[model samples]
Target chain A: EIARAAAALLRKVKGPVGPLAGRKVLITAGPTHEPIDPVRYIANRSSGKQGYAIAAAAAAAGAEVTLVSGPVSLADPDGVTVVRVESAREMLTAVEAALPADVAIMAAAVADWRMAEDAAQKIKKDGSGKPPTLQFAENPDILATLGHHAALRPRLLVGFAAETQNVLDNAASKLTRKNADWIVANDVSPATGIMGGDRNTVHLVSRDGVEDWPDLAKGEVATRLVERIAFALGARDA
Target chain B: EIARAAAALLRKVKGPVGPLAGRKVLITAGPTHEPIDPVRYIANRSSGKQGYAIAAAAAAAGAEVTLVSGPVSLADPDGVTVVRVESAREMLTAVEAALPADVAIMAAAVADWRMAEDAAQKIKKDGSGKPPTLQFAENPDILATLGHHAALRPRLLVGFAAETQNVLDNAASKLTRKNADWIVANDVSPATGIMGGDRNTVHLVSRDGVEDWPDLAKGEVATRLVERIAFALGARDA
Candidate 1:
């Protein structure tokens, strides 16, 4: 009916994803802020380029994409629903709200620890000899949570492993541990210029083996990933 | 005569300066990344908007401006020289190289500690029993270092205090402790929407006591602050 006509229109518009039309894609991106005070928070080197690129790519392929993003200075991608969040907990909540998707990509650099209890007031430095000790609590493991969930789990679950050394082994281990179908691994060494830079060299680790992806722009990476995803989903249906 | 003519041309182009013309201004902006490993670093909730705004404003006032910035998603301002760095140490070096200015503003949220010695490889968590312990080394205090330097010290030094409570008191304390001439204090409580937000409510604390400033956009604050600086310098030179 109306939905099928709209899907057909989208399929006509996006030739690359004629099969991907009407599919729902969920993505998470950026660095989660762990509030220390109202003013200060702990964050990392996540510019949201990769996740934004993925969201854009999925949308271009005619997927209904919902992007749950942490605080980032990036423009929202066209045709994608964006939910802005501040912390790991909030990001998890947003992800849950955007669930029941066909595919899920967890690419955000989530902080492992946050202040157990955020100080309502900014912590003052006493001219005292010792600095204040910060106590941390473990953040929710978003990938593992969704992967292990009984219901509301996406058909295809993907995670990211931003590693420095032993990249392949670490990524392989994470693929099993997180129960993720695929783990996109990359080295974020300062020398690599991948942390906040546009270029990335990643490997896709799956149950079969690792596929070493060539160095490319983040946007190109997203495009290739989406094409692979479309092919796999089409094969599954066939 | 040639130098004076060039100065006159620049002043004609940027008409805001009453006394900032021909003056050298140095500014530091953004959050310093303290490396934990090749993949991770500690950072704060700093967008560098305020510091960048100050640099742009100073340049608009016909000042020879040098902005030393850490990792931030911002384009370099026209008519301002920008030195980019990743960590606090690098920022300090860049700031030192751009020194001997008429005015210096420290707006970088520098991490207090970095990994004592960064692991060459990413630290892996054993599924065993416990998380790996992290050791940290204190970072150099760039504000105090510059403020105390005999030869490289600027004529007018300013520091900022992003406080949640006792804003004026903390700012005053920081002014004396850091040897800065003025302290710009702000409440960054979540209620204020100031941290990583565009609008700011700041208090200018000087030897003459506190001047409560109204909430305004970061760019507006920069403009007014530059005006005040121009006035002060004009009076001193006169």
Candidate 2:
């Protein structure tokens, strides 16, 4: 335990060598599993690849990063603190707790709805073939919550819009609705192979305009996004 | 292609050594993903560990094994013909295709219901606070289908009953309702940690009576089950 503390202290005291050296970056990633019962759940197809890559890039660039992740088969990125959560509500709570950041990226594909009332026991099929009617409850929107925070809101908030149709228009609207500085939008239609695939083709939507980006590896997209963030921050300071 | 064919021929010609050498066993394992949309799905907590273990054990006993599996991260077991599938309907189709076996085990946690009509586009959240009303359609009962198959019904049919309450009673009812010879029943309450855990404590519910099993590793359970299967088959032949 002592040695572990010393290692953490060393990391805290490491030299300020990168553009984001003093920045605290908070990121959310993966698909939240909303319980319908003790055995079954509702889930999305986000693989957490892009968000994990971004976290790794931020850490490499000397940022103090906190990643609020949902259920995913992924290892924690090096030099970043990761808080694992299961449901959208839990992810929101974790994201709120890691507040007062320089930048916050809401990259997780959060479930839009959860069971109105999760059953304690597994629901069995009655002899009759009639199916159950599932009543859904809207899940807490993590990005909007952070955007509307009275205080401790990140200076530059980013949100992701994964859409099956009208990707750019949906992303542009999301930027205004969520009060985010930028909305990284992508076509996640099944045919695109983007939901769980490593390669991503994203468009940057902001107040200025939309910039269409070519297809690239998730890691490359992270690197490019980080560079743009640094430039944007430097311009604002100037 | 020639090398592969030669390898297959060699396996086919290998001396009949183990007790199950001349037998053919059919198994189904894992959780079916019932799609709600292109991005979201309904899933269960089954990790497919127990069923995969049984497949491996059966193959080791020299049975010609065919395993129909749902979405799982496990690698295919050595010498087993694995058929991968996604939804409950698809799984039923695959199981029907690989029929006429000496023994059949239905271990998959198939979805009880799926969307009545899957959305072609990603469902958008309207301004209203009210969530969508999901209409479910009952999925096919793979175990019951096999049990009622007139011509291709296996000599020994095994089903699994994963219950959070009334473990024994549920198993017994399932045996009668599904026309299964045995039901490997287990309590999968979150507290039990058996759904995704490496260990299991299962009860064998048969016509004779319920046999309580001690907590054992999944692999050990598979081994013992295979031994019982061999003995039962031998006794029947005698």
Candidate 3:
């Protein structure tokens, strides 16, 4: 028994002992900036707190984590390999490069549109009262692309849906449309203060059913989610 | 001699000492966010570092500083009253409310335009590949409005022009058009690393001519600018 206890302590001390040992976890975080010019861009209100917490939790679980993050003020999580990018296209490239993982979590709030013809110089006022019309182009859907990548797609794919209305319905639809195994949905209404807040109340939507989670600190949510992921992967292996 | 030394020490320790003692200075900093929807907004690359440094310097120089700042990650400077705003219109209102100052420095990268009618909800991508056309409306010119305010126009009005090209020419034209006493211009090209970098090489433009400042840390620039403002105010008084 003493020998077994010593071995367990050694396992905890050394690398790759947890349930996620030897597994690869890939995650995307932050808001993608879609440039309109050299100086300006369009961005969302994602603070990247939840995703960063999840990354940290995964790394703590002894997973070989690769995080593809956009421009965020967050520091790199301990024991995680981070690849930083600015725009959605760059993020997609980075994510693709870090793929072939056991789990892929799409948590970044990717911009849907970008300037079709970004101005070379600052767009100046022509002294006319009228403002210039802006032309936008649709950005590549990163989650959908990963979901459709049959050969290299992660064994368990997760996506996030931040909606103001019909949160569960939107999340369920997203799960099917994106071919993701689970959708973490949250109401990001301005009144909710969830976009940049530390605490979140997320609902887990899967093919089986929806699990409404209580309001919890983002770190707690991450820990619970990571635990669930380990169980799911164990079941899959069994 | 002992009494004189004691008086000097007291002055140094007391409130409102230095060149700008008993002066009121109003400054604006950071980039304004123009909302397109609840989730996304257009923003510039202004880090608010330069402006925040200036506010700190002004406060250290014994000026009663009112800093009208936009959304920035920076903490409020010591002894400075900071009014936080998000959009250009809100910034204008805040600046106007903190008016009738001895000096005004417009350093914020205020958006020239905002959405004509921002959406109440997050915009979703349709099945079509095309993106929706966006309409913009011009924002109020805070600097120009203050310059044109004859009754409460500051004794020394300053503005900043962050340009990628035609830096000097744009600054010179802006000095005259905005009726500002000086224009602090800098090349914010990505190559220069000035937009969000610590070091800056700025040119001070005025009716007299341009003064090319050496590349200096942002804090040093702020100190020098505050000294110049004090000198200018003294000269005006003389």
On DockQ, the leading prediction is 2
> Residue A90, candidate 3: how far off, in angstroms?
0.5
Fraction of native A-B contacts kept, per candidate: 0.51, 0.94, 0.80
TM-score for chain B of each model, two decimals: 0.91, 0.94, 0.94
DockQ rank order: 2, 3, 1
What are the per-model DockQ values?
A: 0.46, 0.83, 0.80
Residue pairs of candidate 2 with colliding backbone atoms: none
Q: How do the candidates rank by lDDT, highest first?
A: 3, 2, 1
Q: lDDT score, residue B148, model 2?
A: 91
For candidate 3 chain B, which ten residues in a row score worst on lDDT?
B7-16
Q: What TM-score does chain A reach in every model? A: 0.92, 0.94, 0.94
TM-score of 1: 0.86
Local distance difference test values of all predictions, in order = 0.85, 0.92, 0.93
Q: Candidate 3 — which pairs collide?
A: none
Interface RMSD of 2: 0.7
Which pairs clash (backbone N, Cα, C closer than 3 Å) in model 1?
none
Question: Per-residue lDDT of B1-238 in model 2, one digit per residue for the tens?
Answer: 9986775676668854477888999999999999988999999999999999999999988899999999999999998999999999999999999988999989899999999998888888988998988889999999988899999989999999999999999999999999999999999999999999999999999999999999999999999999999999999999
Question: What is the C-alpha lDDT profile of model 3 across B120-228, one tens digit per residue?
Answer: 9888776687898888999999999998997999999999999989999989988888899999999998899988889999999999999999999999999999999
Cα error, candidate 3, residue B128 (Å): 2.2
How would you encode candidate 2's per-residue C-alpha lDDT over A146-185 as one tens digit per residue? 8888887788999999999999989988898889999999
Per-residue error for A162 in candidate 1, Å, reads 1.9
TM-score of candidate 2 versus the correct structure, residues matched by position: 0.95
lDDT of 3 at A30: 95
Q: Per-residue alpha-carbon lDDT of model 1 for B1-238, expressed as tens digits?
A: 9987887786678653545778999998888887766665667778899999999999988788999998888899888999999888898899889888999999887766666787787666666434466665667788889889988888899888887677888888889888999988888767887767899889999999999999899999999999999888888888
